[model samples]
Target: MANAERRYSKDHEWVRVEGNEAYIGITEFAQDQLGDIVYVELPEVSSSVEKDEVVCAVESVKTAADIISPVSGTVIAINEELADQPEMINEDPYSAWIMQIELSDPTELGELMNAAEYATYCENEE
Candidate 1:
């Protein structure tokens, strides 16, 4: 696993950049709140995604939620492992990333909060 800086969004998504590509997944806090994950629908490879767009959908036992894109780019790859074992998400959200994207604007990362700020933001959520 590469070193991933936990930058986040108000929508409960996390973005971690490596080189010019970005890896994305929901936080552990989010998966825990959602309960057991049964399926994942990742964005098609090469599809363009805009920031805040619904890039994928995660289906838990109770509900299906969109995994919004935190930064815009072309989706280069997806985690095929999740399709076979969605519980991997429940076990480790960060490791079970939904997709990898080639960011259109790397600077967009500066706009997101760091781990501490994201934790504080989560606490302030309703």
Candidate 2:
């Protein structure tokens, strides 16, 4: 189930916005598809990313996948714990945020889907 407070992208990335900052991570569906996560390549803290850009990469036992940015912003922080425990994402993708960015354009959020819309989108894909 998608979190009501967060927005989702067609690429299966989720963004939880808090004021000017947005916490970014892959959706539960994404992690499930990837299988057991083995490693995560976290983006640099000060890096700038445009919407749809690859923020980082996640490697699972089955395959490796890029994590796209759902919003344009300067990455301000990352969940360093992922370095040692990448399985945290598979366990709880919502709480295991890969990065937090200072949103460069808040309006870009409008381009993303709400929880319900994303749920429908995922259904269509499946």
Candidate 3:
């Protein structure tokens, strides 16, 4: 089940807003499809990103995928722990967020899908 508090993208990324910042990561469905995660290439802190832009890369045993940013923002922080424990994403995609961004346009969040909608979207994709 997708977390109710977060919004999801058709590209399979999830974003949870807290104050003015949004934490981003791949959805659980995405990780399951990707197989075992082997490495994660995160964006540098303070980098600016536009909505739908490729913000990072996730490499799994099966294949590699680009993680798209769901909203425009300036990257405030990245999960440095992922550098040593990439598998943590497979362990828990929701808790193992890849990056945090200070939202440049909070209204952009309105375009994202809610948990239930995302669940339906994933069902259709499968």
lDDT of 2: 0.92
In lDDT terms, how accurate is model 1?
Answer: 0.86
lDDT per residue (tens digit) for residues 2-106 in model 3: 978999999999999999999999999999999899999999999999998998899998788999899998999999999999999999999999999999999
Residue-pair clash count for candidate 3 = 0
TM-score of 3: 0.98
Assess the local accuracy of residue 125 in candidate 2 as a C-alpha lDDT between 0 and 100.
85
Per-model TM against the reference: 0.93, 0.97, 0.98
Each model's lDDT comes to 0.86, 0.92, 0.95
Arranged by lDDT, best first: 3, 2, 1
Residue pairs with clashing backbones, model 2:
none
Better of 2 and 3 by TM-score: 3
Model 2, C-alpha of 97: deviation from truth (Å): 0.3
For residue 35, model 1's alpha carbon misses the true position, in angstroms, by 0.2
36-63 per-residue lDDT for model 2 (tens digits): 9999999998999998888689999888
Error of 2 at 106 (Å): 0.4
Clash statistics: count for each candidate: 0, 0, 0
Who is ahead in TM-score, 1 or 2? 2
- Measured by TM-score, the strongest candidate is 3
